[model samples]
Target: MSDVNVIPDMIADPSAFEDDAAFRLKAAQAAIRRECGWHVMPNTALSGVINTRGGSVIRLPARHVTSIESLTDRDGNKLAYAYDPETGLVESLSGGFPAGIAAIRYEIHAGYDDAPDVQSVLISAAKRAGMSPVGLVTSQSTNGSSASFDVVSLMQAEKDKLKPYRLGGLP
Candidate 1:
């Protein structure tokens, strides 16, 4: 996935970000991607490999796939397939994928062109990381005040918003 610096512009004051803000933002992006099981922003072509256990239907390791640039087997043989752009499901038209490690290689365009909810979640996470004192403060209390930070992970609300874009089954 490409490095997208959207958090800086999303913030009301870019200066509010600390010196480690870039790192924090990157970490936030990575965390979201990890949760989603794919790069969920900036639609682009990505090359990847998937192992299959002899199945006609193979789900790509991505979401919102716009197109498949190429799909080949281990022997570099192009395979005929049909795919759903929304769910990343590919149906083999010729035959089921052979069972093996790294049996399929593909280049595909996937992810969202404009996902405001995803961007919002990323910004929220980045801001939370920036405000943390030790970068690991899950919960803290001072005098009569108490606060908890999700830190590198998403809160339940954020996860709910991103559920549709998530890969595999359930978060």
Candidate 2:
């Protein structure tokens, strides 16, 4: 709930920084990580059968997955699995996700699990690239209470830091 940044703060404010305050942490983390992902927290983990396409590895739930807390089946039995913490690839230990009715469910904590040294880099990025700016206030509705902010994308410098952990292992 608190971890979800599903909404872009039109009233952008990273000043609202709390360790767990909001998605800014991951927005920053995502920016630092420079990849797409589910970014799951304890409460937000999704449950479902991830089709393995007749293989041992299940496609990562998102652009990235930080950790796999557990894997289970429809019977609610825990299944053994392995994964690359870097690439988010999970493979069945005993066998594949199995070739039958979709039954495997996942409980993963996805996203950049660690903090980068340059959080400010990400915060600055959010203000500049994370949000969109309104071009020319056409009406000026005089809403009494007003707010303003800018959004920015992850800078090339910032992205470079995450390259080692990046998929394809780009150097």
Q: List the candidate 2 regions with Cα displacement exceeding 4 Å.
A: 1-34, 40-49, 62-68, 84-87, 99-103, 110-113, 127-151, 165-171
lDDT of 1 by residue, 44-73 (tens): 989978889978999988888888899999
lDDT of 2 at 119: 52
Poorest 10 consecutive residues by lDDT, candidate 2: 135-144
On lDDT, the leading prediction is 1
What tens digits encode model 2's per-residue C-alpha lDDT throughout 66-134?
A: 556768876778888887765556778887676556667677654444445345566666555434344
Model 2, residue pairs in steric clash: 36-63, 127-150, 128-151, 128-152, 129-151, 129-152, 129-153, 130-151, 130-152, 131-151
Q: What's the TM-score of every candidate structure?
A: 0.76, 0.48
Report the error of model 1 at residue 7, Å: 32
